[model samples]
Each structure stands twice: as C-alpha cells, then as structure tokens.
Target: MTPAAIIEPPAMMELHRVWKVYSVGPVKVPALSDVSFQVTKGEFVTLHGPSGAGKTTLLRLLYREEIPSEGEIQVLGLDLARARRGEVAALRRSIGVVFQDARLLPGRTVYENVAFVLRVLGTPRREITARVFEALRAVGLSARAQAYPAQLSQGEAQRAALARAIARKPLLLIADEPTGNLDEGMAAEVLDVIRDVWAGGTTVLVATHQKALARTLRRRTLTLQNGRLLKDEG
Candidate 1:
C-alpha cells in the first residue's frame, strides 16, 4: 500500500486497544487481547511470559512483520496501519532484532555477518569498517571477527549476533529470548552485551520466560498470560 504523509508519533510507540487474532482452519484464536501500551524513547522494557503468551507475537507486530487484527500501532512515528511498504522497510531499518538462536550465516565471518546489514543499508565502506569494529569490541569479540559462525562456541555465536544487531546503531533493539538457548554463564555474557548497548542509549525490549533475567536487569517488566497482559513491574 502507498504510504501516507509521515506523522511524528507523540511517543516512541503507542498501541491503543490492540488485538491480534489468527485463523487456524475455521476457528479464530486470539494471540493478543486488547493489549494497549506505549514505550518511551530510549527506555528499556521486558516482556516476560511462558510459551504461547503472546510475547513473540507482540514483538512481530511492533516490527511490522505482521499487523494487529484490531487497533492502532504507531512506532517510531510511523503508523503501521497506514505505513507504505517503503515506510515499513525504513522503520524496520531503525530497529534491530535478535532471536533465541544466534541466526548468524554459517559461511560468513563474524565481521562479514555484522557488515551485511550495513551493506544493505548502503553505508560507506569506511563507516561500516568502523562500526563493525565498534560493535565487535562492545561484545568483546574483536579477536573473532574473522571466525566463521560454525567455528564459534554457542556463547561466541550469540555475541556475534549481538554485534551484528548493534553494528548499525539502531534506535530500538528487540531481543526475543536472546539467551534462551544458553547456559547461565553464557546467558549472563549475552545479557552483559545487551546492558552495554543499553548503556549506550539504545532503547531495548527483551522477551524471555526467564523471570530472573528481568529482575537481574532491573528494568520494567510487562507480563503476558494467555494473550492478556497480567502484570507490569519495575
């Protein structure tokens, strides 16, 4: 669809009475029921819940991979309902996402994996070189820049994923269970990388079933249960 004139959002995000329903055969199931919330710029937040509680669904909607069945979602000043293809693409470019498994390219070196995103965004070679190093340094993986994903340990792979996400210096980082596959020690390492990025002023939203991680981060937490918001604690 064609985009409308850009309208600056009043906040970093605004979701009013949002609902997301999916069709499985004939019956419809709700993934998010009347979820309404906003995230302020540069704020760190967590969405923690057990499986099937809509955390991932909510993140997908925010990133524009899917649209809510009902309600308004304005993120980073772009109205999802009205945002054109280019607008959505631009919006996504401003956000970074990480998954439970470090989705690094098996064949690419760590530095190339990080550089891919910048190349897609048309960044200059010199700037990409600087940013890639900066990101790798932040994740403590400078020495492994030439290592292939398959050669790295799980922890190193996750660190490389973090470096790739933060290389472009996106405004928002949405990590969906980034440490889900890690041991406590490895998870702690990943969390440290996230904390460093947050300290650098990137707004972050992490989804995890691990309650302790949320508490350890000492960030605001939003809990979802069976598609409904249950609790919000800081």
Candidate 2:
C-alpha cells in the first residue's frame, strides 16, 4: 500500500481555551484559565502582567514545557497534548525561547553555546558553523564568539542566548521576562535584537511587567490578571 502525503501546517502557534492547574497537597491552584490566543508569522506581541498572573504559565504552554489541563495547544500544527515524545521534540525544534537569565553553559565559548542546540538537533558541523556565525552576527556578538560566558558582560551573555535561540531560525520566539535581569539601557539593547528577530519574520511573544518598555516597543499587549486575560491591546 502507498503511504499518504503529509499535510503542511498553517499558523505557527496557537492556543485554544487552555488551562493549567497545579495540585499541591489536595488543593488546586490555577495558573491559567481558558486562555485562548494565536501568534501568526511575523507578529510581535507582549504578555504584560504582575507576578502570579499566569503570564509564564501561558508562555510555558506555548513552548510545550507544560501541558494544559483543560484545553489544546497547537504549535506548528502539532497537537502538543496528543503528540508522541519524538513528535513533541520535533515540534520544539521550531520554537525558540529566552528566559530571564541568559542560561549559557558556563564553560563553553559563546560560539559553542550558541551552536549547542543545533548540535543536539543533529545539524551538520559545517552548517552549524555557518548558522552559528550568522546568528552571532545577527546579535552583534560575532567578535566575541570565542569568549566564555563568564568573560562576557551581562548584556553580551544575553545576546549570546538570543543568538542561540535564533540559530535554528525558529518560527516562534517565546521570551519570559527576558529583560528582567538587565539594566534599562541593556534591556533596550536586548529589545532591539528581539525587534530585529520579529522583523526577520519570526513571531515573538514576550512576557514582561515593564509597562514603559512594552509601550516603547509599540507591539500588541495582552494583559493578564488573576489567571484571566483582561485586555488585548494592539
């Protein structure tokens, strides 16, 4: 018998009535409740809310790190809830993430750290070199490729993390409080790189509490409060 042709996926990322609940000692704690949103190609969006408002929970759901308790999440056309382990891994390859900390491997050089994901995903060595350098160049860290994480400045390390995320040319980029650890000026610089990534056609979703910075970016803002989506402003 002949095998069926594979169907291509539509939107890059999607969330439908998603909910996340944490069980602690017979009590249920809800982080996200019926959150529904979609991020298309080339859009820049920010999730703004105070701590414990389900911002991180929502981002985690999109990244497939945490499964929703009540609804479905489709990323790159893969149903995260129903996907096999290998399928989920493949789905994650198309998503990039930046956490509050740079989270670079301490001993590895900037280049190696940026190339780590590509190496794990079995990209060819030659292609890894080319892609790593290109990503570093995109984040303005090509000159510091050989520097260790400890040797670089905070901003430089964050930029290296950014380079790592974009090295694979992911369709969606999720950042959770990415600027939380940087100073105002350094945060702006990081935001500039994020804007560049969005301009390059990757959808961006940033979870941050910095209202001023969010306004400066002029992107759509999804405000969350008490585990609920309060406002979506464009």
Best prediction by TM-score: 1
Task: Write candidate 1's Cα lDDT for 57-172 as tens digits.
Answer: 99999989889999999999899999999999888888999999999988899999999989998889879999999999999999999999999989999999999898888899
* Least well predicted 10-residue stretch by lDDT in candidate 2: 5-14
Model 1: how far residue 149 lies from native, Å: 0.7
- Residue 209 of model 1 has an lDDT of 88
Question: What residue runs in model 1 are displaced by over 4 Å at the alpha carbon?
Answer: 1-10
Q: After superposition, which runs of candidate 2 have C-alpha atoms over 4 Å from their true positions?
A: 1-10
For model 2 the TM-score comes to 0.93
Report lDDT (CA) for all predictions. 0.91, 0.88
Candidate 2 lDDT over 1-234, as tens digits, reads 878988643576778888889999999999988888876667889999888999988888876778899988888888887899899887788888999999999989999998888999888888999999999999999999999999988888898999999999998899999899899888988999999999998989999988887788788899998788889889
- State how far residue 198 of model 1 sits from its true place (Å): 0.8
